[model samples]
Target: MSDSTPGRPPALPVTFRPAHTRAVLLTAGAALFVVITLIALLLDHLSPGERVSFVFTAALLAGVLFLLARPKVVADEAGVTVVNIVSRRRLEWAEILQVNLRPGDPWVFLDLSDGTSLPALGIQPGIARQRAVSDARALRALAEDRSTPGDAAPPG
Candidate 1:
């Protein structure tokens, strides 16, 4: 079925990490690290050194990275963009071969003509169901249209 509506712009497909989940995880990690550090500090007889402090600092830094490093799925008229913490990949509408909705999968994978798969990194099926489904439908429609008889193949 045609995915676009008469006047409405095609929805911007975005898979956002839930703020609450991020906050909870970060908070828990920070709390645990702090408690452990405090315990280490209190046991003076054990002679904790700079190494213990360094370990706690590293744990805190890791927690911060985890909190901030979430992915996003963005779609527009031109194509779809899968944005991760360190990189962003843009796939044009014509390049998308198919969109599959596998509910139990960790993330969505796009099947390309060259037998390679581009992952929708930001989309977590269990966490972002509705948005993922909407984007999948739109991508599927675009892929179908592009694969018609007269259309050109997408670039590698």
Candidate 2:
């Protein structure tokens, strides 16, 4: 009953952790929050105007937490969902023109039909090389399975 191609297994969904930068930022933000709270408390004794400063600090902390907690990417049989640090984009399997697994790249960049690229979190070279290879292969497989026979272009 499945519409999937014969002889090719479906791609399993994979969720990648947030990029290392995100973790570092989150940790720094938490530390900053603690330090700011302590400073605010100390200032409380010296000046009544410290309340306004505390409010600004709280807002900044909240913004940082929100950014750090955002999802990076979600991949599945159908396609990949890339949640950039500030935005989200969903690409269907057939729409993916290429996947780059080059060294030094922060993440897997998926080339689209329009010549633009979207990042997949799993392809981060910062992770183990084996993991990057596996993720790249998986993405290649998905692209091949979904593409027409003649459209099996090499990944960039």
Candidate 3:
């Protein structure tokens, strides 16, 4: 079935991220960072070494929080881009052979024609599941369309 309505654009390259999870992670991180930094700056009795340590800890916490919230998958007309903390990958639409978003799966897996299972971070199973499923349908449709012999999904 077509997901596109007459006035709406076909959904492809759907971005799936657990919004509440990410928001909580970021908010907590920011609050912790700010609190730690302010305490470090305001504590008049802190030794030079302790102040330096607090600064380091605040920076470290912020960095870790960013890393934790850094994974996402984008499936666009061109292909899919899986961006995880510290690494990223791109696969063309024609390269995807299957889209797997089974029960209990953390995210959808793209079974590539090359025999590798690539994770689609955006089409996750938890948090906003309805949206995730809809995105998955869009992904599968796009992948299938591209796999066909003629009139493949737009890829550029």
Q: Go through the candidates in order and give each one's C-alpha lDDT.
A: 0.62, 0.66, 0.76
Q: Which ranges in model 3 have alpha carbons more than 4 Å from their true place?
A: 1-9, 12-14, 150-156
Using all chains and alpha carbons, the TM-scores for the candidates as numbered come to 0.57, 0.68, 0.80
Q: Give the per-residue lDDT digits (tens) of candidate 3, residues 1-156.
A: 126554343576467565666777799889989999999999999998999999899989988997878877776878878787678899888788888888788888889878989776656657677667666766677777666766555577
Clashing pairs in 2: none
Highest TM-score among the candidates is held by which one?
A: 3
Q: Give the TM-score of candidate 1.
A: 0.57
lDDT computed for candidate 1: 0.62
lDDT string for model 1 (9-108, tens) is 3444533343444555567777767776767776766545664775668587766656454666666656777776667888776677777768676666
lDDT of 1 at 55: 63
**Position 33, candidate 2: lDDT:** 75
What would the per-residue lDDT of candidate 2 be over residues 94-132, giving only the tens digit for each residue?
788887878677777888888887777645656356555
Worst 10-residue lDDT window, candidate 3: 1-10
